[model samples]
Target: MPWLARSRPLFPAALLTASWWGKVLEGGRAAPRNGRCVMAPVRAVVRLRRRVCLQRKRRVLGPPAGPEAAVAAGAPGPGGGSPGQPRFFTFDDPAALPARTPRKRRRRSRVVLYPDGARRCRPRAERRSSRAQRCLLLLVAIVGFQVLNAIENLDDNAQRYDLDGLEKALQRAVFGQPAAVARIVALLRDYLATHVHSRPLLLALLGPSGVGKSHVGRLLAGHFGAVLEDRSLVLQYHAGHHCPEARAVQLCGDELERSVADVVARAEAEEKTPLVLLDQVELMPGALLDRVLGLLQPQRPHPFQNAIYVLLSGAGGAEVTRFVLQNVTRAAPGETQDEAHAGPRAHQTDMELRAGLRALLAGAHPLWQAAAIVPFLLLDRHSVVSCFQEEMAGEGFFPEQARAERLAAQLSYYRVAGHEFAVTGCKQVVAKVNLL
Candidate 1:
């Protein structure tokens, strides 16, 4: 009776029916025990009747609010039972559902108070100290000073020998032999870089007679003449001109020895490296080559040690000609056009050529073993035309290209690989220009 007081007024019939069931279940009585009212064993069954009465009351009225509202308004729960199945206070009842409560995350606090923004973090320490920075600066300064000194020293040495002028003059005078000119300049640069020397520098200009070997010899003599400020310091001896076949061999040897002795003595006194140009050395006697080789030895006088000897010989002319012909015949189009891409191949070819010439000449004369061999290649048709034009201009002509080409066409050439190479080179250019 006390629990029936909670029954809704809108569901009087359901409440009354459920109350009758609750009374039957409880036997409608609370027994007196030890002078106190006590609940009967059927108290649980009475509570179940009350819950069922509530559910019936909810169905008669509108659905409850919140999670229970969906349970009341929606269809029956899963595992819908038959009419004979037990229906008292099962989880399938719509009014028994509980409301959902989301779980809370266990997050830590991120915010904190700081006295000052600038000092909020520990200051990052430098990897190096002030003393280390000073040492690094001092090292940089010393390295820079050393590099500058080396560069200045190189420039002074090069200027002392006038290498720049010599390279330029050789380039202007010599054509179709860029490798030869470059090697010659590089050798001179290396040798003249320092005043001290272990032995003399002997550069053998080996090529066929008209490939500007003599012209290069002349240019070197002229340039060194102005640089040394003493014509006596430059000795240019032509075997064919200075010592003819009619002259006694002993007389010629003595004359050459005396001239070299005087030049070397003067150069040593002046503390300079004299230039000795020996032209047509292929025609020179064996005794003369021995004498020249003696001067290049370490046991020679101090003056001999400080001199530069250039031997222009035609001994390797046949080899140089054969090498050029074979190259022209076998060379690919790319080999002639793309030099940068074919650098290794070209360098290999040069090494082979130098090796071949060295082997050939070294066998003939021991002096050539120590000499720097510069091989002059054959001149092309264009270089021959240029030479013709140059000779013409020197002879006070207009130096017309068409006229020069016409003159160049008269010369003989060895045609190979769709190109023409002058057989006589620029040797006959002077004679042809003089006739005009």
Candidate 2:
């Protein structure tokens, strides 16, 4: 009872000691009042003490260790129950023990032993092998393809001019001058392909009065004027018409400068190229030629530099006629040009003729020095006949070949080297055709 009031917990030995004290103090020899024995009081007190000690042990240590561990060690515990009895969670229960936490293990590489030494290599991450050469080849192929494509495109720049049409027109219009036509077309094809030019193209068409120089000029002017779709852009500067004997040279020069400036400036503003045709340039005064030459200078502005200047002059006519009569072979009826101006010899003669003409003109005026001199050779009787037929056809007349031959026979010719070179070429064809 005292232990209950105090509420102090004790071990099983303390309980037994407490019970014995109670027995000694209250002398378990008490007389029985009714049928109860004095030993009954002592037994009740012993039971109460045992129950208190059991509660103290339960509080001190959480559900103890498993009974299997004690049994394995061959030690009998206070509550190591037999296998047949169902195990309760107690100081002997294996299930009641706290679980152990698992730990992460670090990986260590195996030692690589060699005859001479030992080495430790760290594990590497997996990776694909390099294909640098194959990659380089693929890159090269791509770049080369792009470069080749770009090269092919550069040739396409000359396509817009319809050079084929222009070539055909020149061939048909300018007879007895296939080489000249080809040269003009070639030069134009090269120049018009791209807009950016270092200096203006100076074309000097040097020939006599009858040799289709002015005709070519007119054809070109018409073609370009039509192509550009702007008549104002084509500047036709006829030396005889523009700068007459009555007009002052200085005033003519001023007018020429202003007109050229206006045309080039307007064309440039419109992002277009202009053609400046100066026909009968030989008749042009030196003062005017100087002004024109000044415009052709490299230092000129972009507008002035981007234009084309053609000089149709009869300055080297005598030299051209003399060369044709002396060096050129006679015409064999249908094959005069083919027989005379054929093969490499004809090419050499043609080159020499042009060089001579260039030298002759360069002495007369410094303008010719910078120009691309295209000498118009004397036309043969066959070319003159063709010219007559062309003019007749153009003038709404039936161009009968026999009638054209009869008409061409009327014209005078320089009979030399088995060929009849026309003295006045197709110059008289237009007049003759008009009469028909």
Candidate 3:
């Protein structure tokens, strides 16, 4: 009778029991036996669960129309408000709520100062010191290498023979071309003095075979302390066959440029002036000749600024010889020779040489026209005799001067018309001396 007095007439006991059992199972507790009243703890849990469910349903369905409607729908008011007044909920202060166990903050590694005034992170200091040491070591190594390189360069420069001595040596080594020798020496002197950018020294050695064209180049190479036979800095191409054909070639366009650039780069890296000797250049095809000339053009920066190009051509050899012979002073019917006569004759010879060379190269490219033509004159009997003597002395073939002179005299000399001619120049002389 008491339970009936507290219970609402609209509420069903079966629904309440089922809901209570559901909440107990949801809370991970076993449901009690059937037909038994729930315990006090279970009843409190069911009351709280019912309150939460009623609040959620009110939110979704919106608030009931009035307290009577709420009570009729079996929705309890907060703190069991009277049926006449609207229910109002109150919240406890966040600070007054049960304090949560404070989560422990992870301590980050930090650089701490010790009582001894040293940093606590020794590894960081060690790392910094090690990095500084490595940088210092690298810098020192770089400086040392540069110093050694500079010293080596200085020593090399110091060891080089003076240009004057080199010129004299070249003159002695190459015979029968005094004018050519003097001009070459002057050219070299000018090149050394005024190394104007983009203007490389070009020498065209024009003469017959065995007239010391190649020998002059060798002398120049030796003067510069470079080995002419070495193909690195001194590029020697026998243009007759060794030069690549213009159309039928492996390396062309960019490949050709790269190859040439690589060679020039190597010479520059070694601080050496590249010397290019094109032997029998007249025999080279027009295309290949143009390619070589393009390297010397001034439009772009090139390693050829310090380079020396020696072009050996036998094409104009006959004209050179004829021009030299025609300029020889043969007193015109008792005209007395004097110092004035000597100057005029020398001037006339130079004029004839230039004229002849110009005529010979008129059909060729302008590049060849701009070159300094050095005529390697045919060696006279005297020069050839001297060459023979020098060779004999070198080989220890003739310790006695008398034997060398006799052998030189016995060598057959050719006669063209009335003038004496050493047809093979110093080549035959050297051979004759070697044979003896």
Q: Tens digit of lDDT per residue, candidate 2, span 1-436?
A: 4564454443454567567668767987554466454456556555666556655554554433555554443334556644333444444446755754444588999976665565745456434436897798899999999988765654564554567889999887778887778788888888876767888898888887788898898998898888788999999998888899899999999999999999999999877779999988877878888998999887888889888899898899999999888875543445666345654566677789899998888888899999998888888887888888888888999989999999999999998857788888888888888777
- Residue lDDT tens for model 3, 178-209: 66777778776666543234677788888877
Query: Which stretch of 10 consecutive residues in model 3 shows the poorest summed lDDT?
Result: 333-342
Instruction: Tell me the spans in candidate 3 whose CA falls farther than 4 Å from its real position.
Output: 1-161, 194-196, 226-231, 244-260, 270-272, 330-344, 399-419
- Who is ahead in lDDT, 2 or 3? 2
- Order of the predicted models by TM-score, top scorer first: 2, 1, 3
For candidate 3, the clash count comes to 0
Model 1 bad stretches (over 4 Å): 1-151, 330-344
Off by over 4 Å in 2: 1-157, 330-334
Error of 2 at 201 (Å): 0.6
Q: What CA RMSD would you report for each candidate?
A: 16.9, 19.2, 23.0
Ranking by lDDT: 2, 1, 3
Give each model a TM-score: 0.64, 0.66, 0.54
lDDT (0-100) at residue 6 of candidate 3? 50
